[model samples]
Target chain A: MTGMVAAFTATILAAGSTTLLLAVASLVVATILGMGAAFAKLSGNRLLRTIASAYTFVVRGIPDLVVMLLIYYSLPALLNQWIDAMGIDARVEFPPIVAGIATLGLIFGAYMTETFKTALQNIPKGQIEAAIAYGLTRRRMFVCIILPQLIRLALPGFTNNWLVLAKATALVSLIGLQDVMFRAKGAAEATGMPFTFYLIAAGFYLFVTVFSLILLALLARRFEIGLRELAP
Target chain B: MNWDVIAENLPLYAEGAKLTLLLAVVSLALSFVLAVPLAFLRNGRVPAVRYAVLGYTLVFRGTPLLVQLFLVYFGLAQFELIRASVFWPWLSSPMVCVLLTFVLNTTAYSTEIFAGGLRHIPVGEIEAARAYGMSRRAQAFRILIPGMLTRSLPLYGNEMIMMLHATALASTVTLLETTGVARRITLNYYIQFEPYVTAAAIYLTLTFVLVSGFQLIQRRWAGYLESRIG
Candidate 1:
């Protein structure tokens, strides 16, 4: 009995770690894509703005699982067809993790774009003008002026997005990723105690959520050091 | 593009779309009913009641809906007591289980949104009601509830859209919702892109409709605030 308990614990912990890693990796991808899309939406080019708007609209409209399944099953099929047409002696494959991350990153990237856009707009326009007037290089201006304020302004929305994204990692298990949900299902089947195993999985997610809330709250405070809340 | 497979499966997709809408609408309506009382309790003066509601929201919102669904569906069957109970038949049905999970999940979120709306009600409005010698019940019925609903319309609309998207999860538990039909087509035809794309298109249209519907409703319900600002 002890041995069985130990094995179950080990499996769940490892799977939990995988879920965390997938979430972090997908968040990094989402942040980058979101930043780029935000700039595109804000850019003067009409085509860029339209494309960015369409990206967010379509992504936000569809279900995450549907998108994930579409990418997971269709991308490789499309690639292999292209390979066959080219007479290449190779096949392309997408591991579940890769597909999971790509789908999530792409979906949440749309959300992050909205958050970043609002944050960017909230920054005083004069700050940018002042930076340009002072002859600061564009890169330096962004780094020294825009970036800090953007982080502070965007943190609340970022925290909300991150929490939602972390919870969304559970969907990856449906595609055969060995995340906590998948492992919990496995354990449930093996032990014939689905309730216990699933409850444990819920506990793991709850812990992550509570921990994140605390961590992000601290980060928000850290970013707010030089600012004061206006009286309501 | 497997046009033949898609054409043959059109009826199935339509049926699935109806089921999807059913699940989403039923769950959203039920959650709205459940959320109203819970939201009030969350803002109630009693510490224990407020905390209890808080605890419920925390657990439901913190954990993924899939886990909750699995726990209710597969986990409950593990118990002999539940199996022997009269409720077992209802609980055993996949549709019931999915609906139950969705209602619980959406209620948690909607509770918070509604509570926030209640909190944001201008203090002056409440004071005015009090000064007018309105009874507590009258103030609640005429002032508080309407204000919260109107103030929370936009957020509630968002929750409605989310519930629609979440109905796709019903496919996982053997319900032939839109995504379920898509999955079935993929299995049957050994073709992936067309079925899922069809489902996506259907979902996108639903989302667009919901957004436009909410915009009209918002203009109707919250237009006074807008006119004031303008």
Candidate 2:
């Protein structure tokens, strides 16, 4: 019993950090995919737009749990088949963290694309015209006219996606990842103090959520001043 | 690729889908019933009642639904007092436990949405109601409830769709909903991946349908205010 208690206390903090790490990693991946997909959706090519929309459609439509399960359980066989065909001796299965981040990143990437695509399109037409008339390069125009307002406009949706993504990091526990949730479940099972451990896990999630809100608000405020200077 | 296995289990998947839909509907209906009054109470002039609802919403909204599910499903059984209490029979069943959790969780979220809508009711309108000597019940039903529900319909629709997605989590608690049967099918036929695909397809289809359903409902009830409502 004492040993179980010690293990529970030790894991609570360690797993908390891992969950944060997972959320951060997933956010980074989502950002990259979001930007790429957003550009694709904005492009003149019909095929590019179709593919981009399809990606977002399927991802946004499906539940996160189903995706997580599919990625974890279904991908290994395909990887093995490829490895065997290539004459490699090694076998491949995603580490639980790898699968968790990949699926979350993909799922949230679709949401980000929606945010980015709409924000990009909604930038005032006059701003771009002014930048072009000033003989600015495309890159310069984007930097001067598009990026600032885009960030300001996209901040609310971005913050929402991040909060949701953070909450979703809990599902990693279902796939056998030793995030705080998994550890809490184990402790609750062993110590027979489920209410305490699970409540603590909930507290951990709430703490991260509240802290992220503060950080994101400060970020939004930072960009908001630039927006005010531009438009106010 | 195992068409045989997937084909054989189509009925089972359908059953699982039915379970998922049933669970979501029951949870959503109960939560709505509980939330309307709670929303009214929270928006009332009483600070104490408002704060109590505030705390309830904060805790439920702050944490993940998955955590709440585990806590309610597993946590309640840990207490001898609860086990000895008359409510133990309901709490002991995973189905009821999950329903209880969903009702509480959705109540918190829906209350906020409803209250926000209520808050948007112009103060002038309330004063006008009072000036006309309208009773509180008359004012509530005729003015407040009608407008609030109309304005909040779109947002509440989104919440309902989210709750529908959350039914997927029922599998985590060992409930044999769509996702649960998906898990079982995957285990039973480790060589085949079609079951997972089928499950995803089912969820995606349901989401589109629900999204369209919400659109139709909004178009019907709040259609006249479409220029302002959505």
Give lDDT tens digits, candidate 2, residues B1-230: 47789889999999999998999999999998889899999887999999999989888988999999999999988899999999998888999988889889899999999999999888998999999999999999988988888889977987887798889999988999889898898787775367788899998998899999889888888886777645
The TM-score leader among the candidates is 1
Off by over 4 Å in 2: A1-7, A81-90, A226-232, B122-134, B228-230
lDDT of 2 by residue, A1-232 (tens): 7676667867886888899999999999999999899999999999999999999989988889989887987777667767888999998788999999999999999999999998998888888888988999999887877888889988998998898898899999998999999999998988899988899899988888789889989998899886577694
Query: lDDT (CA) for every model shown?
Result: 0.93, 0.89
Off by over 4 Å in 1: A1-3, A229-232, B227-230
Winning candidate number (DockQ): 1
Tens-digit lDDT track of model 1 for A1-232: 6587568867987888899999999999999999999999999999999999999999999999899988998777778888888999998889999998999999999999999999999999999999999999999999999999999999999998999899999999999999999999998899888898899899999999999999999999888976756434
Pairs of residues at least 3 apart in sequence or in different chains that clash in candidate 2: none
Q: State how far residue A43 of model 2 sits from its true place (Å).
A: 2.8
C-alpha lDDT of residue A201 in model 1:
94
Model 1 chain A TM-score equals 0.94
Best by lDDT: 1
lDDT score, candidate 2, position A209? 78
